[model samples]
Target: MSSSAFKSSERKLEAQVKLNDYFQEFHEKFVETKQAFQVFKTKSFFYPDPDFIRTFTKSIKQIESEVKEMGGSLSRLIGNQLGTHTQKTVLNSMEDVKPESHVLHTVSDELTSEHADVLVKGTETESITPPVSEAGNDDEVLGSALVQEGNVKVVDVKKKLSSSEKKRGRKKFLGDNAVIPKRPRRSLMDEYVTAQNKMKSISEEPSTKEQEAEYEVQTIMDFKKSQGQYFYKVSWRGYSVEDNSWEPSSNLTGCEDLLLEFYKSRLKQQERTKTDDLNYQVMPHDANHQHILHKALFSHINNPTQKDYENSITLLASPKPPVLKSQKEIAELADKALSQKKKDRFYSVAKTLVENMIMKELTGKREKQLAELRTWERNMNSICSDPAKLAVENFVDLELPPMDFVYINECIAGEGVTIPSDPVVGCECTDCFTDHKSCCPNQMNSWFAYNKLGRLKVSLGTPIYECNKRCKCGPSCLNRVVQKGRNVGLSIFRTTNGRGWGVKAMENIKKDSLVTEYVGEIITSEEAERRGKIYDAQGCTYLFDLDYDKGDQNLYTIDAAKCGNVSHFINHSCDPNLLVFNVWVDCLDPDLPRLALFAAHDIKKGEELTFDYNSGLNSKQMAGRLPAQLTEQKEEGCFTPEKRKESRSELILKTPKGNRGLQYVLNVSIFHNVYQ
Candidate 1:
């Protein structure tokens, strides 16, 4: 054969080898997936599928067989080009490239009984070296003998120190959180010691004046980029253009949601401007038609003819004494010009000035209706020491739950779910919030048991709903508690129970206090089901079926399994301090109500926060059991959307109408630890 032909044949062989490696890798992953599924099947349900092991094994063998056949075919194609000898050599090479099958044994061991030999022969692992027995039982001899056998290891266990031995000298810890445990009961002398060590925390709190001022971010006036830092010229609430000051990103601190909203709005505005510019064809200037900006800004003026347009430009172009106008005045004039966008280019050449004029968000009424789209709560990586291991994206001092997280602002309508348009044209009273109730569209009427500032009056099971942006109530409205970001201190803790992880209160939480909003990617039922299978195999599911209304058949689900907030850390408890509520704000869509988890009763600091999976309703009916699927009986104040197998009396008492069906029939056995 010619040299070129030989080189071509060699390239073909290389490609065949690459294909073989990929197929082998895929075959191993397939085996692992099969093993994972079998594990899930056996452990997830009380009565696991009897034929699961047989079926899984069959599937794995079939897939591996196909992979081998594919590799063989590729080998044949390349081998035919060379001679019969080359083909035999290639086939021989394939025999040596077998992937390890350890997963099969691991998965099969759990399923096997004394009578069943589930593990196949040749796949079984045996000890490479036989177990050695020492000639003597003496400790020194055994230890020496183990050392002599290079394969054996002699481990010397260290003796633990007693509390008394360690307490002889006072020790200092390196970490900031290190603390010495104290007795529960303290005498008068202990109080003196405590007083001597305590520092005044009052000086650390924000001043009364500062707290009273409702600060909000409206417009990003200017952006300054520095050597690793970014600063924004912010317009504070109740402040004018002249009073606006440049603030560091740190000063905005907990208001990351607002900053993200500002970013998204700017992006949208840029997109709209591009669309607007695209809509207009770049035709040669029609002198008769003035620029759109000029026309819109000075719409009060009469129609300008072609000659009059020329005169306006001439007057604007004329060299006059430069006026010392303030930035606020310039911004105001620009705001007027660009704000009134009636697309009749009054001054065609004033494109530069028009581009510079931006309408900020934090100004006037827009600041009050805090419903804009936000991007991030905060950059988790910047705040967290390790972000990959933590399930959530926000900074939490403790380890997060063993789950995935994705951030989202609002819940979207899932498949088969319908968002009802039952928006109450709420009362426009500025004092409705001040009074802690509203008569307009009086939903579930005995207004929520919240204070004038929206805090819970006492630990009660009443649901809380804040006045939406549609209402004329101001930002400080008492009904607007949930929207104000995380108000109570919370910590994501690793649960001691088999329930994985959960959230705990860092401070005492009153009854009806907002814990955290159950935020995550709002996906459709189809997408949810597709993901459900994968999550099921992994043995952890965070998909929540939204049943805020039973009238709507379209099932909606929030799959917080992947993307979620701190609420994902709140685990299920049969007797729970927290309860989930369907809160509607912004647009009144019945189908896409926000899942707000509030305290059902007062919670002590350091206590784990939990809510029943389906909240006193049957689990199968709502399919609300998460991760570990366990069916539970209904409890009192069962406010879930869908109720299954209700008797005639139960149905009559609990209809999905307004406040008429809001009565609670309390149950006693609700506090048991039955929830998983």
Candidate 2:
């Protein structure tokens, strides 16, 4: 043979080897898919998982592309050989073509199973066929074979199956016909691409519907009047601006506040010179205008009641500046603007200027209040030596820093109330719990309140008597925990629910750990009654009655409304994690015991800390043990702890003032043994 001919033969042999390798890979993938399906069939009575089917289908598509490429190469090779031989000789050669055992040998090497054996046995009895091209004559049959291992059976690639045989099962025969459908060669590639597109479309249809269904209006961005009808541009939550769309005003029924806000922003953006324009309106509708007028009037009425004053403060703290206009001024402006509808209306622009001035004043006040709160937080933190830090957050509303509310870590004697100034006798023991003799617990004639871990070892209602200032034990004394103050990180956050300010644990708190003392003005019971009535009328109470003696004549009370620690901000929960205990420290006066709060359970970080404001009182006991004002308030549906569920986190009570009138015997604080 000539050099060129020899080179051509070598190239053809290389192409054949490449084609064999591709076929062997495709065959192995097919075998694995079959085995997966078989296992799936055994495990489930139904069809295989859709995800598996999708993956297998993708593999099949890749193999089909490879098969098409191989077919094209084979067709070229056959055409080249045909140039030197007659059509009759080519047909004779194809008839004599045999199955390649090496392909099967390669497949067997990779897969070992009964399925592999069945496939290899079937291939031995079948002939491999090279696919016939569409351009080839109908009578011309090209043949070759892949004789390999597995349960997979092979049939003639060109064999025309009867309708009955086709209906028997959906078993796929490995050949060019299976990989690429029989069609006009011009449109074959286009059909495969179309099938893939159809599959993708079907798979993506549900997600598109889900996306449409999930679309929610996060806020109204802008509004426009088109042909006298309003259209608000709404931004959807969890999506970008690209997904925003304009919807008719009627479509946004429940989003009136958002619409009102958008209108307010638009009004703010308007030029000051346009105030005289009759069309310069604060709201799109008369009802919205009336709503704003009502709110402004109710919030800033002259000789305002306590509730009205509180409303004014809340509005003043609003992130958006209040546009305060008198009702009379609004009415006069509306009438003047309406009467001169046919002509140009001349409205005074002073109202806008007044609104701006008022906003500036309120903004200044809010800034000052916020600064005061920050200072208060700093001062409180400075008084503590604990590693835990205190943080404040208020995104709910512009609630000012509480007025006349003193942050005290220890109880202070109020008017008509007296706390003993003398220090309690000291414990000389090295380990108070180990050496119970002369220890604080021995002095109290009770068991040591804490175990080795510095957690409360006593039962829930036990009184804790810690080493006092005169104690021989050092500051590290485990029994000196409550006196040392809060060591756990805590955050004072403004609750979204109408429950006002609340405290949440910033770090995980173990069960029976000392949280904080409910320090406030210690008042006598007679004073608490007078204050409780006033608090009830004002819809708030901070009077915690010291009813530890369990007598009808309770002597003292801890009033925390204006004077308290971080405990004052703590809300009430139906399923409370905090329990109060009477803790005696520096002052051993039984009537003036310190109220301490302790973790009732292992509390997770970020979980809001709450104590039972009702002090675990049953309905009958509540009526008898609680203050008269509280009982009256309860009867009128103001203090209903029984109706609230733990899931709500904060107690849903009708009070602007946070505290639940009084605390009784069984409540607050953990006690630990001595470290001395």
Candidate 3:
């Protein structure tokens, strides 16, 4: 019975009448607008009535727009009832062919012309009816119609087009000269390379003085020169932004007032930037780490118990009903589970639903956080995020304890430190690793034996000589140890021991590992002597004398007491794992060579790394390169094992004479620990 009633309503048609009524009212206004546009074009454009012309143009545009809209709706609302008439109209439109010449028309002109054509073409619309005889033909009819961006006219028809194509409507038939932006122009520069496109855009501008009635310019965007004459990029009062052109000063006379205002505004903007109060306005730092810091801050998690979490965004939105997306997914899972085969042993509907919901809550938040972190990683700038590239020489005072030294990458000039200017030593070794007979070994009997990884095989108390840049043996030379720079990880930390601060091995460092350069300002022997007196008063000293070759022409001292590398923090130790060595590379300047420290033994992870600092340069080291010792020099040094029994007799009762035996015992302990 319900189906029968729907069929009955179908025969007696409805719903379309509301659309027809709306279009009927709209069509009346459209006809009225078409007539008014004709009168204004003939009178208002030519006559000098600024306000009336504006009002007249506005009225015409509004009405034309309604009519165009009405045409589309009327076609849709009328449906099959007006099918024959629409088909005839489309056929007639096809007969009206397009012209070959290109026509570039603005919105205003297009609208004006459309209305004018409506008034003229009103009579021809009737004659377009398909003859009563041809109405039965299927191939010769258009049962559907299309409208453009509110352009309602049967102006074009292409047969055999799909329904979607017909609904999309037709474009204007343009000639070859039409500038349709089809594919993106890969390079306009390519086109400008030829002589043809080298156009003089403003060869001659319209001069207001010459043609005051025709010239029009409203405001200036930018300034330029054309053919040696000054011009402004002028936006005409009644035209679009695209219609702006480079008009000469003579042409912009009409808009001088506006042009003056533009310059004044620009000047004010400049002044605002220059103002002292705003000159240092905080902005995003150019460094990448600053940006990363900002992003990380915004994403910082706020705990529920924190004071700020009371106003937390998550808590604030919690009261709102949870979005139904998760529930929907859970329900879908329940349904899927219910349909699953019993043999497959799928979960029950209740279990599946509960699990799905639990999983959704868990995975959803995780997915969101992962997505955000991934976005942050992708957005991280190359320069700022990479710690290695970031040149942060100085440590933050709050995070690090007060160091009585400045931070510096390389050595600077000081009282006693003089930079070296010496000749170099070259090596003739083809492969320093395999061939122990390399020229480098012949020169100094290479202190360290190394593998391909440049780790030391055994610790030998000898001077280290590396291959220079002049060597043809290449960078992988075994003797080329210290100059390659510190490779193994190490950390500087404040010590619990009497030693104030020290360097620690972050990794298992092999015996004879090139730890770090003892970088500092190289001072002269005279300067070293003066600074020693000052350090004695201060109760601290970071000066090391270069006595490797003993009294050279230039006796130098490295004063890392003020500024230096990781090696500067290495505290002195009587039983040290690290040993100091004079490593020469780049320049074989024996006078002021680099002082590199190497592990004297296999240092374990987390072990304190130290070298004998105040100890005299004994063994192969040349003497007489040092200043007077500010160090507490013991009157009695360590004793031998043979003398221990006799030495103990003098030490048993805590006598001043027994102090030598105690010192001797301590020295022996240090010697054994270092060697072991």
Tens-digit per-residue lDDT, 136-243, candidate 2: 332222232322232224434356566556434212432332222121111111122333333344343343224335556789876567777767789999998899
Task: Assess candidate 1 and give its lDDT.
Answer: 0.44
Candidate 1 accuracy as TM-score = 0.33
Off by over 4 Å in 3: 1-400, 413-418, 436-438, 444-453, 457-460, 551-554, 615-676
- Each candidate structure's TM-score, on Cα atoms with residue i matched to residue i, is 0.33, 0.40, 0.33
Best by TM-score: 2
Q: Give the TM-score of candidate 2.
A: 0.40
Give Cα-based local distance difference scores for all models.
0.44, 0.55, 0.45
Scored against the true structure, residue 172 in model 1 reaches a CA lDDT of 32
119 in model 2: Cα distance from truth in Å? 99
Q: Cα lDDT of model 2 overall?
A: 0.55
Q: Candidate 2: deviation at residue 447, Å?
A: 1.6
What is the C-alpha local distance difference test score of candidate 3? Answer: 0.45
lDDT of 3 by residue, 1-676 (tens): 2557634433333344334334444544444444454545446443445455557656655654455444544434343433356434532343233211111112112333222232222221111222233233222232211122333355332266564553343244343344332211011111112211111221133321243354466766766545655555778778888888875554442353565455445433433453334332122121212223223222221112332322222322232423434545654553353233341222244343333333344445534544543443233223122122111111111122333555555556675344653435666778665554547645554433355656544322334567777777776666677766677776655454445556777778876567777877878878877888888788877777665554333376778777776677777666666656556676566665677677766889888787665433331221221111112222123111111112222211110110011111112233232233
